[model samples]
Structures are given as C-alpha cells and as structure tokens.
Target: MRQEDIWDADTAARYDTPGTGMFAPDVVGPAVDRLAALAGGGRALEFAIGTGRVAVPLAARGVPVTGIELSQAMLQRLREKADEAAIPVVVGDMATATAPGEYTLVYLVYNTISNLLTQAEQVACFRNAARHLAPGGRFVIELEVPDLRRLPPGQPAVVFAAEPGYLGVDTFDVLQQHLVSHHFTFDPLITGDRQARVGRSPHRYIWPAELDLMGQLAGFDLESRHADWRGTEFTADSPGHVSVYRTAGKPVSSGP
Candidate 1:
C-alpha cells in the first residue's frame, strides 16, 4: 500500500506514543536541540509533519514553522496540539507541495523519507526541499539503515522485534529496493482484555550513500552525519542516522 494510505484516522490517533522511545524527554530533547541549532534563528519547515511530534516543541523553541503533509487525519491531530497561526501546514504530498515561504532548515524526521515509494519521488522530495529553503539553508533527514544483512542468504524477510505485546517484522525486495514493515500489536480496548491490531507500511529504502547522491542532485552538499541527534559517531553497527545537507550554491557555516 502507499505511504499516504497508511496514515489514516486510526494510525494518526496513536502515532504519538507518549511514553515510548520517540516522545521520551531524553529522545525529544536531543532531537530538538540538534534541529533548533541547525535552524540558525530562522524559519523551519517539516516534511510529513505527522501529529506535530517534533514540530510542536520546536515551534515552542521560538522558531517559526511550516509543514507539508498528505494525510488530513494526521493534520487533524496536529491541529489539536497547535493553532494554525502558530504552525501553518499545507495539506499535500511532500514531494510536490510548496509551503508559503522559504526556510533556513527543512527536516524529514524518523525515517519519513522512506514513505516515498519510488526513487523518482524521493529525488523530487530533495528538489522540493531545496526549493523551499533559503540559500545556505540545510536539509536534515533522520532515517534507519536497511537491515538486509540480517536476512539469510536466501531469505528476504526478518523479524526484528518480538515481545509480549508486540511483534514487528520487515520483508525486503532487494531487486526493487522495496521494503514492507509489518506490525502486530495487542491492546485491551474491549472487555478489558487483549485486542489484536495489525499494520504495515511499504517503503523504498535508500542507502545513506544513495541519499547523499540524491542531495547532490538537488544542489546540496553533505554537512554532517551522526548516529543520533546527540551527534554520536555513526559506526557500522548503528541502525539509524541523522544527516544534514546544506545547499551548495550558498555559503553555510559548518559548525557544531
């Protein structure tokens, strides 16, 4: 299924897991800290700003913010958190939608880039971000590295997470660079007992190196890359990364 279709009323409702790894203070603190510093006291934009998980707090940090999102259900949740004036959002595809004005920083966080199911769309996303950014502005992305090494020689699927209440697995189509993450969750919604829920989202996973090439194609230069928001070194074992790509034609400060 398409990425846009994956985020419906149901998914949007539960997107922000308050106590989960994403929303915890430690995780949120570092991410906002890094992004705000990159914003450089100017306007910021978010691609696929679902539920305002990071946008809300970043705006609270005194940066004017805008967003482009395809899912109205997700936008509805964001609206509940912040007024439209505080965070203006365009309801359209991130790969093509244009938010009002230019920004100093444009960020797609938490593996959102994978949402675009094709390489062409992903490249367009880079160009779209470049168009919205002011000269010298930066484009930031937080994404997970594909875990294909875990797949046995002939296997194209792997179950990464299995627990008492949840199960998560990923299947890969190496030839097409496509992946689908499957999730099964248990909750007690009725009868005060366990209720089973299932979800899946398809993605075209791009490698870190390929992503850099995409940035270059969109007139960007790689500024920095880290294993996390805290700027840890990205080593072989790192599962995800935070990358910053500055527009090449303009002079941007390469600093911490």
Candidate 2:
C-alpha cells in the first residue's frame, strides 16, 4: 500500500475509534505541555495533528496552536473537534509544509516523524521545521525507541497485538531502514466477517543520537532529552524518547 493511503480520510476517521487512546493522553499530553513551555507562551505548530487530541487541549490551556496535517479526513476531524472546542489548524504535508509565520515552538508528536519513510524526507521535515521557527525557538519530537536488536536473526516479521483480535504484524526491510505494519482486525462481519481490516503504515525509526544528528543538520542544538512526558531519566531501557531542540541562529547547509 502507498504511504498516503494509510492516513487518508477513511483511516483518519478511525484513528480514535477504539483501543488507540492509550498513548495519546499519558504520552502525548505532557510532551505538548513541555513543548508549550519552551515556546514561552507564543504561537506553536503541531505537525501531523490528528483529530485535535493534543492540539485542542493545548489550545484550551490558552496556547494558540496551528496544526499542519496531510490527511483531509484527519484535518476534517480536527476541524470538527476544534470547532466544538474552538481551535485552529492548517492542512498540508508535514515534511514540506510552510506556516504563515515563525513560531516559538514547532513540534512533531506521537512518533509522527516515523511516518516519513526515508531519511531524506525526515531530514527535510527537520529543515522545514527550522524554516518555520524563530531564532531560539524550540523543536520537540516524541517517538518510540526502536527495538531493532530485539528482532531474531533471520526473522523478517514481528507480531504485535495491542489486544485480542486486533493484531499489527510488522515487517522490516533492514537494508532500507523501512518498516511496514499491517493492522488486522479479527471481526469479519463489520468487514465481511472472514476478512480483516488491513491498513499499512510505513515508518523509518531513528535513534535519539540519529535524531540529534538530524537536528544539528537543521541548525538546532539539543536542548534536553527525556524518557517520558513527566521528565523521567532517559536510559537504554526507556520505552519512549523525547528530545527538545533549540533552533540556532541559522540553518545548516548539509548533513543527515
């Protein structure tokens, strides 16, 4: 399946349907708060804002948030939620989207960076974010720690079941640093009973050190790193990785 198809309207509408909000509150909310504090009460940009889960709450806290999203369906859901809660958003691709003005804080939350399938696209995302940030502004990213070492040698697929009857089978192409997960639903009636709901999301997982290199390439300095939203110590065993980067005076011409 194509990358664009995974986040299209139909998929976006089902984003928060069931068994998906676990990470949103515990992981995403506090991270956004930290990013907002870094912004020092100025305007902020949320890359890949889906359904306004984090954006709406952040806006309710009195922070004016401008969201950039590629899926019209996701943006539509976001707009509906925003209208109910009164927030604003911008619809576009995150790797290349340009906002109206420089922001004090630019953030890509919920492992959204992995949505970009290649290193070049991910680097472009950092560069584009730098372009939208004012001098001294911060760019925050939240992602899951890639567990490449856990994969058994010669095994190409790993099964991840978030719950009974709902499975995500992940296939990795190590040479390309690309991974795709097929979401399978056990219930066939809603989806023909015998057939599963298949959705593929392509991702490129980068380590904290690699992300730091990307930040340096984008003319940003690593400000802080955290294990979770509550500012826990970041260690090798941490489940989540949070990194805050400060936009330096200028942009870097090259690197990856």
Instruction: Write candidate 1's Cα lDDT for 39-76 as tens digits.
Output: 98889999999899899999999988899899999999
lDDT of each: 0.90, 0.79
Residue-level lDDT tens digits of model 2 in 36-139: 56768788888988887778778878878888878777777777667733655666788887878778888888789999988989999999899988888888
After TM-score superposition, the amount by which residue 3's alpha carbon in candidate 2 deviates from its true location, in angstroms, is 3.5
TM-scores for every predicted model: 0.95, 0.89
Q: Alpha-carbon error at 146 in model 1, in Å?
A: 1.0
Candidate 1 local lDDT, residue 213: 99
How high a TM-score does candidate 2 get? 0.89
User: lDDT: which candidate is best?
Assistant: 1
